[model samples]
Target: MKQCLHFLHTALFARAEELLAKRIIDGDPLAYFLQGQLYFEEGWYDEALAQFEKIKEMDFQALYQLGVMYYDGLGTKEDPEKGVEYMKIIINSNSPKARHLKYAAAYNLGRSYFEGCGVKHSDKEAERLWIIAADHGNPKASVKAQSTLGMFYSTSNPKDLKKAFFWHSEACGNGSLESQGILGVMYLYGQGIRQNTKAALECLKEAAERGNIYAQGHLVEYYYKRKFYTKAAAFARRIAENDNIDMLAKITDCLPVYIAKGVAMATFYLARCLQLGVGIQQDQAAAKNYYSRVSVSLQVHSVLLLVLPIDWINKFVSICRR
Candidate 1:
């Protein structure tokens, strides 16, 4: 790990990648997985696919990862049908640990079906698969299931409020900050759970402390709603200080959304540099130009989050103003 950090800091990308490949070839499934990730990051789709495929031979999660890539054309041509085929193999396998893969497969299959991405649309089929996936312990699927169930309940279908609450709570407890933040909002507004500001505050605080932007925004909103300016400012300061790049730079993917996030973050730091006249003169015009370019790039990439969090917006605003 220390060697890897040194390589990254020294920007020896090629050597680092070569070393990673060596590790992969040395019979390390994790190394193979990471090599695949590195290739994906470098946009060497074919190479990435090859590495992931090798890992798939021994790792079920690797299989699922490949299935996702294939489905989204991350490192290969978009082939939802083929993706579904691979998922089906995992879903039908009798391996004990394959249950989680099965759930993931089912969820992906349903997503493909629902979006007609690589299959025909079928709401009924999607709902069925979502239920199966949720039952198999897929936290994401569980949240979706609750959402769909909530929609159903609005039409006088027996509203499984308790079940929805349970699933959302479970997903939150399982480390899904989106779930935590959403559940926090629901509790705060009495959408599903009992109206309990205290519970909402606790949930949002947990998510924010863990570096979840969604949770941070919710925390801000919670504080604002309750006129807690001091708390809001303190959390905002935390946001300003957190080393987002340290965490993000560790990810080795060139996904458009992720790339956009990186660009945005980098632009923000550059702005900070200019504001403080660090490593350069304080040229507000140049700083603004950089931010503008990132904004345009982000817009072109369509990474504005089909569902953006408020904290994200706040971050954007703060950086832009600086």
Candidate 2:
């Protein structure tokens, strides 16, 4: 029975439901809980509430879930006060059964305090509860707590950037995608730790591979600036093919003479790739258009020099020919 219940909670729902049906027919209380969870997942909140209500002696898990339903108005009218009361009861209880329920309850109650849902808005109180919940062995709550702490320390006034770095790094390690991207940027600029270009590239690349768009953009710029034209073109092509015209325009615009020479080289390489179908599809018309624009700009510069002294024009012509 315990193993079946564990399976249900651990998300082997189909198998758990099949096994739980027989136990529920036998009027097992744990089976009621499992059935209630399945019903809740299926959005049959009324049926779930009926099943949960059948457990006359509610354990912490049942009580916590009931509180959640009330607070969210899932199967009943919204009653924040009632939800808060139920959560408080679980927090104050020393019951050995379903002890893990405290982490979820505490996390939810902390959010209520944070948002002034049912309780008065109190950041300190919310932080306290989050700390407790985070320490209670819940991975979700722990990630939330670490992410919140990272943001809290990331302020600029009395900069606790080192602590911010630590929290974000820890959160990233714990699978927080936002933290991974933020930490990558931080490493790039040496916000708290020493700037390590290699480490920053590695971190941003990892995040980009995991579908972080911001990291992808940064990688495009990084490779372009470093004269890694092939890599820059690849990343830029991804953004362009995804229909991000603004970003593609930004990549192309980097070729202006006033910008770094490496940027121009990268842009030219990208245009060539698009033109020749090197790594991406051939777009000869688009390539010709870009090349024409570059030529027009250089011609404009040459025409401007035509107004200069005859000696300067001769020298400029000589330089252009060379």
Give the alpha carbon lDDT tens digit for every residue of 212-244 in model 2. 555665666577667666677786655433333
Instruction: Kindly report which residue stretches of model 2 are placed more than 4 angstroms away from their true locations once superposed.
Output: 1-18, 76-79, 136-141, 155-159, 224-322
Model 1, residue 69: distance off in Å is 2.2
Tens digit of lDDT per residue, candidate 1, span 87-161?
A: 877888999867756766877787777777777888678767767876734454545544443333322245555
For all predicted structures, in order, the TM-scores are: 0.58, 0.60
State each model's CA lDDT, in order: 0.62, 0.65
Best by TM-score: 2
RMSD (Å) per prediction: 8.9, 14.0
Off by over 4 Å in 1: 1-44, 51-63, 94-100, 136-163, 233-322
Relative to the true structure, candidate 2 reaches a TM of 0.60
Where does the lowest 10-residue lDDT sum fall in candidate 1?
249-258
